[model samples]
Target: MSKKNEVSFFDGKGLRNDGRRLDELRPIELEVGVLDNASGSALIRQGGNRILVGVFGPREIHPKHLALPNRATLRCRYHMAPFSVEDRKHPAPSRRETEISKVIREALEPVVFTEYYPRTTIDVYIEVLEANGGTRCSGITAASLALADAGVPMRDLVVACASGKVGGKIVLDLNDFEDKYGEADMPVAILPHLDRVLLLQMDGNLTPKEFHEALDLAIEGSKRIYEMQKKALRDSYPIPDEPQEEEVVEVEK
Candidate 1:
């Protein structure tokens, strides 16, 4: 995009654009309960990019054909702001966004205990206020956290992260510039407790072995993110394991 864009990951001393090591993510900041009306919501800011997500329903299925008697349905919508990019993105769901939304829904379906609510629906809406790169991963990350905040039952929370090849080396969490010039990208979603992947996608080019290595790097990064998620949720809602208030005795005649 920019002529000043430099190939990251092997910059002689091996430092990335934001001074992170190859396997480090660009610092992520997450906030829940940001939206007033949504049933569940969260916002994620990874470096300069900003993504806000709102999850509604487990309520009902629309259009009728989309409904299933056996299990609930999961729906996702991802969009970018007009000024989110340097080139200015349109306020519509591009073809890429459509495909990504489907994948994201599939990713969370496994983590969500959908069978608990049969013949229902869950809607996850993600809006990217800024796009420096890796918005899809950020959206997924924010959506998962929002779902939990909404009091949805789930087997485990999903943490999404990405890794890619830059200057012939697998770099964890590609920033804006590296993604444009880098060789390949692999984004993944991990179930924290099980430590297993739920969503995986790769683009561009890489050897099969390199792909595996990249995946490992992404998983490592996701775990770090998972820790952050847990801390954030706890900080927002802290409860004592045991009751703190003393019970009042009642004297009746």
Candidate 2:
């Protein structure tokens, strides 16, 4: 087997190249109702990644055949702009985009009360204006806020974060450089109030012990992000009772 490249991800001072501690998450900024036209919208900036999500629906499905008979069909599209990354990508949807879209949808479906709006459709559009790494997790975080902004009936808010192993140490929230060279990446999503796992995906290898550590770190990061999500929503509209999914206020923005 070929030898792994020798790269220094952490400095002698125990800080990563980005100057963050192993268990520290990158900076995050969130905004709600950024788009005036959409039923609901949210923008998130996590590290160097920027993702915007717009939610539309609980409205009638376009083609009659696509609508679910018993519950609302959740349709999601995750698209990264051609200029979003270092290397310019094509405008068309790539295979990775397709996969992430499906992943986001599945992660979100469990919380939405689709049964409330039978035969309707809830459409979510995620636009990645920039990507450094961990866009999938960031996307889920923003999408959940957008759904709340749209006043969709949901059992709870979903939040996500990623942790990985780099340089033989597990770290929280991998950046692009670390993800590209790191030994492993695990992105996790959960319903904070419900304490249920909505999504968990891993790439690369880790020992059972390392896996548990990484999962714990990711959950910690997600809980922090969840607080921000609630704050952003509250800033836009009053949150009478948080995590009490039934109290979601319908935002007109």
Candidate 3:
């Protein structure tokens, strides 16, 4: 209830520390099929967060016991580079990363037509090249695009975004500073075409009204991101120009 040692997140002029409005999101850049060797890949930059996602398979599952009888199993691995954050993290997978990987897989499974590839497995790997905040949501966005680029059949593309309460005001897309100091944070993913929520997670505290407002802001942000994702896929494969017919050379012949 008292602002003491907290950093000044908002100025009197209604601008955040990064100079964005409460409802404004950081700039986002997306590219699909970025990796040549992988079946499909995508890279995304949101503010200072950078994530690369690779999708492989629909191939036979190894260790046979892990294979599903009715539908393709979805496996995900979310990792952070040792230098991704200010402090170097261990190269090995941490518990947090494992949990995030599981959540991401569940988030994507609902949209994928896994039944079409029974007894197979689709693997998605997400690597955080740089992390300022909201890596999980960004990873999910990248993974979904990568899956689509890999030619995986899906009901719809999944889009994700986060909204949080910073300086006692609801803000869309929290940066590292906001995430560290914000009172509440919520990350959500959705199937834009179906208007169905695929993932939702929250931390800290919020009232009923604030909760709905934050959720609405996140949904709007995801819709904007959806457009960029589609554009990236389209840009990856440009249409070739039609060849022009040569004029008749009857006289020469």
Candidate 4:
């Protein structure tokens, strides 16, 4: 990685520090409903990065006191694959992952209709198959898709994106180099339907006006991603043909 903050690295002849243009996004690929065992599942590919998300039942609750009297419990787990990073990751959950999981759970709770399944709990699992710069935001995006695919009622689709300043230029959807050396990074989860924000995190430094500009850029990037999520879901599950019944006739001689 470069120094703490430098945009000179992005001077790759009109391309980003990572060789991508300012308006360009990493190539994205998606598949939904991949795990039949789970209520809903999705796999997302954004360039070399991959993430899988699983949604499991509003089933009976455990550790009962945590359960709310009026609503079901929402549980979220975010973990990295052992081989997700350049170095093998430890099997046990890291403090960073745990903190991310906690924050994601909070961001998702308001969108989920937990009240409908009182005394129950729904598990949202995110596994990072590969790592890029924006894994957490990717996890948020995948988890929301999995929940929606599972037929869970939600108020709106949550889309997440990260923005940062590189070489004195504010950019949307940062990549590895930009994030590692960024002056400021703002990651956010936005409700595309309602034009609202749920989760927002900032790292590094920026002026208040610059922060507002970064926030707006993040929201704009998220909206575009939200559209892709909707398209992925629609493509994954086509309308099933009507069931066919076997015709019965007299036994053959």
Candidate 5:
């Protein structure tokens, strides 16, 4: 590795390149109801990543053979635009995209009340407008919000976060540079209200102790994000204030 790459992840003060503490996440912003055409849509920006998710259906599933007998089948597509990264990605879906799509579908399936809409399909589309790292986790986060915005009944919202080891220490929400050169990266998703783990995937190696630490950190980060997700949904529907009673209207009449 070049000298710059060697010391690129951390400094003598034990802070990451972006000046975040070991357990600190990148700044996150989330919004819902962004796409007018979709039944439900959401967007999330975390660090340098930008992801949009749109949810459509509990609509009839064409190719009837694919329909579930007793529950709605969930389909997810995760795609990155050609300009999403430094090197333009191919427009065609890659093996990685295929795998992440499946991962996101599974991660969300548990929370959805598919039984209520049997013989239908719930389609989730995740588009990565930009990527800096941890796109899978970010995609899951936004996709769940889109599902809620679409008015899909669910047990609870799903939230996700990632943790990894860099420069001999674990860190929360690894950016692209740390993820590329760090020792390990683990992304986790969960149903926050039910306290259920929906998805956990790790890339790279970590000791048993380090793995536990990373998992705990990621979970904490996810819970924090869960609060933000709730706020975004709440903001979309502002409760109208009650109208004030007119005073002395009888005198005017």
Candidate 6:
């Protein structure tokens, strides 16, 4: 391993900076319908990364030119708050944000039943209130939950997660530090039930073997996130009480 990859990101016992095992993911907390104003909303926290997503529409599309005649259009906007990071970022949307927004939309479009709502639009907004790393993946995860909460028909929920090579070891769910210095980082979104890759992106250097290892790790991580998404949706609307049976009145009859 070169000096860059030799940093003690992981100790001899195979523990990361935050004491996570090589294949372990950071803790995650998710909730749905967090915003009353939006049709549906979700908030998710993974380690220091926090993302909020809102879904609106299945309504007529404005500016008629933007609507698709055969299917509903899906639009997504991803933004980072000015105070989300250590250095205050400008509130204006940056080029990076725009690209992320596009990818997020594509990641979700596959599962949504767009054909059911022709000439309409479904808008998804993702706000990164705080970011430590893996914000994009977490944002996509939250967006899918928000869409389901809104009652949008879908084939499956999308789940996303990232893995990277740090300290010459493949690790699941890189944090900010790992992302900045890791040898390689790969983020992926998947349709867990079908085991299909919806989105895949990578940066940095990795051997073919390492790349496959990272992909496998990311896929496993996504499955865990998929379960969490299901729990959040179920918790949002608990089962109602069963109706009580009326008493018989044999004597009166």
> In the order shown, what is each candidate's alpha-carbon RMSD?
4.2, 6.6, 3.2, 4.1, 2.8, 3.8
lDDT score for residue 244 of model 6: 23
Model 4: clashing residue pairs? 7-167, 10-17
lDDT string, candidate 6, 102-163, tens digits = 99999999999999999999999999999999999999999999999999999999999999
Q: How many Å off is the CA of 143 in candidate 3?
A: 0.4
lDDT winner between 2 and 4, please give it.
Answer: 2
Error of 1 at 26 (Å): 0.5
- Model 2 Cα displacement at 42 (Å)? 0.1
After superposing candidate 3 on the true structure, give the runs of residues whose Cα lies further than 4 Å from its correct spot: 1-5, 241-253
- Candidate 2's C-alpha runs over 4 A off are 1-4, 238-253
Q: What is the C-alpha lDDT profile of model 1 across 1-253, one tens digit per residue? A: 4642543345557678678888888989999878888988999999878999999978888887888888888889888888888887777789988998888888898888888777888899999899988988888889998999988898878899999998788899888888877888888888978877888888789898998899888998998998888777766686754334322222221
Can you give the TM-score per candidate against the true fold?
Answer: 0.88, 0.92, 0.93, 0.90, 0.93, 0.92
- Candidates 3 and 6 compared: the better one by TM-score is 3
- Collision count of model 5: 0
- Which of 2 and 3 is the better model by lDDT? 2
Clashes of each: 1, 0, 0, 2, 0, 0
140-176, model 5: which lDDT tens digit per residue?
9999999999999999999999998887788999999
What lDDT tens digits, residue by residue, belong to model 4 across residues 139-251? 89899999998888899878888887877778888877678776777789988888778899988888888898888888888888888999999998676554422222233
lDDT of 3 by residue, 59-121 (tens): 889989999999999999999999999989999999999999999999999999999999999
Q: Alpha carbon lDDT of residue 70, candidate 1?
A: 83
Clashing pairs in 1: 58-121
